[model samples]
Target: MPKTKKLPLNSLEWHQHPKLTTLLSGDCHQLSTLPDLQFISFAQLQSILDSCPIPVVKRAKVDAYYLLAPMPILKQLLGHPDSHKLTASLNIYSEPEPTLSTLALIKPALFYQKYKRLPEILHSRLDKAKSMNLVTPNKNQISQLAQISPSAFRKITHSQGGSHG
Candidate 1:
C-alpha cells in the first residue's frame, strides 16, 4: 500500500462548525494534496493533541474555540416563552465558562448577534436580533427546536462563496 504524505509546517488548522463535532481540523499530512483546511470534533480533538502519539500539533495555538452550553438547556431557552426565562437560562450558562452549548441554548437571533451576525441583516448579529425583551417564546418555537443537540453539527467548508477548502 502507498503511504500518505505529510503537511508542511504551520499547516495544521481547525475551527468550530455549526454541525458535526464542535471543531473541525485538518493536519498538514492531510493538507498537501487536499484543500488547506483541517477539521475535527473540538473535545475529541483537544484530547488527541493533549496526548498525541505522533505529536501532530506543534506550536499549537487555539485559533478559534467556543464555550458551549448543554443542548437541553439551550432547548429549554429556545422553547421558553418568557424573556425572564430566557434571561434566567442565559445566566445559568453565563456563569463560569460559556460553552457553545450555552450559546446553542439561545435562539438563533441572539446567538447570531453575540457571534457578530448583525440583527438587521438577513443573519444579523445577536446584538441586532429582534428584541428578545419584547418577544416571548411560543409553542411553535419550542416545537421547532425539539430535536437539536447543543453542539456544532458540521463545519461548512468552502472557498469564497463556493465549495469548502
Candidate 2:
C-alpha cells in the first residue's frame, strides 16, 4: 500500500482531510457540497438538546415551539412545509440576552421527523447562551402575540420580500 502525506489544517483542501471528512460524513448527512452544509441526525440533535438547553418558546394554540435559527435555515424550513410543520418570523419576543435573529415555529413531531442539523455557528451560539444561563426551562415560554399562524406569518414574510435584518 502507498502512504499519503497528511495536509496541514490551514491548507485550502482542508475539507478533504481524512479526519474532517470522516467526522462530517460519519454523523451528519450532507445537504450541499458548495457551502458544505450537513444536517446531524435527529438522535444526535436530541442528545445535544438533553445537555445544552435550546430555549423553546411554546405556542399553545398551534402546539408548536419557536426556536431560534439562522435566516438561511429558516428560509429552507419555511419552503418545505410537507417535510416539516414550520413557520418562521423575523419578529420575536424581546430578549435581553442571546439577541434574537430568526425564529422557526415548528411542531415537535414534524421537527423531529425532518430534523436538519443546525450549523456549527448556531450550535456555538447555543452553547454560549447555555453557559451564560440565558436559556432556562422556565423562560421557554413566549407571549400569545408571538404565536402567529403559519400561513399568516408566511404571507408577511413573503410580502416583505423575505429579507429581515
Candidate 3:
C-alpha cells in the first residue's frame, strides 16, 4: 500500500477538491465527508468563496434570504470574527428549487430574494472584518498566504469588485 499526502487545509486546491465538487454536484452527504473547518481563516474562506459561486435563494414561506454553500464552507464562515451576526443550518428540500446542504442567514436580513444580488459591501465586510482572534490562521495558512504573490492577492480581492467598505 502507498501513502498519499493529505492536502493542507489552507491550500487553494480545496476549491476543486473532490468533496466540494461532489457537494456542488448535489451530494449532500459529501458535506460530512469534508475535513473539519473550525480553524479555517477568513482569508481562506474568501479564497473558496472566490472560486465557488454559492447562490443566495429565498425559501417559500420564508421572509429571509439564505446563502447556500457546501457545509464545510459554511463552517468556515461560522468561524469568522463577525459570525455572531450570522446563522447557519442544514437545508433539506425537494421542491421549488432542490438544495440539500448548508443555508446561512445574513443578520439584519436581506429583504430581496434575488440570485447573487447580495450587496457588495456585505461581502467586503465579511472579508475585511478585523480578525478578533476568532479563528487563528494556522501555520499552513500563514505559509500559504506568504506564498501568494501580492498581485495574486490583489486579483483575488478585486475580482468581486471595488471594496465598498
- In terms of TM-score, the best-performing candidate is 3
Sort by TM-score, best first: what order?
Answer: 3, 2, 1
- Whichever of 1 and 2 has more TM-score, that candidate is 2
Query: Could you report the Cα RMSD, in angstroms, for every candidate shown?
Result: 20.9, 22.2, 15.1
Per-prediction TM-score, please? 0.16, 0.20, 0.26
Error of 1 at 17 (Å): 7.2
**Worst window of 10 by summed lDDT in candidate 3:** 1-10
* Shift in Å, residue 98, candidate 2: 5.6
lDDT by residue (24-93, candidate 2, tens digit) is 3544443441221124333432343344333333334332334333223333322332324221222223
Candidates 2 and 3, the one with greater TM-score: 3
1-165, model 1: which lDDT tens digit per residue? 112223221232323333313322221222122211122233423343334211111123642222232222322222223312211111112222233433344445455534331111222222223455433223233223322232322232343122211
- Candidate 1: minimum summed lDDT over ten consecutive residues — where? 83-92
Per residue, candidate 3 scores C-alpha lDDT tens digits across 26-104 of 4443223334454655565556654544343444443333333333455555456644543323222222133323322
Better of 2 and 3 by lDDT: 3
Between 1 and 3, whose TM-score is larger?
A: 3
- The clash numbers for all candidates, in the given order, read 42, 0, 0
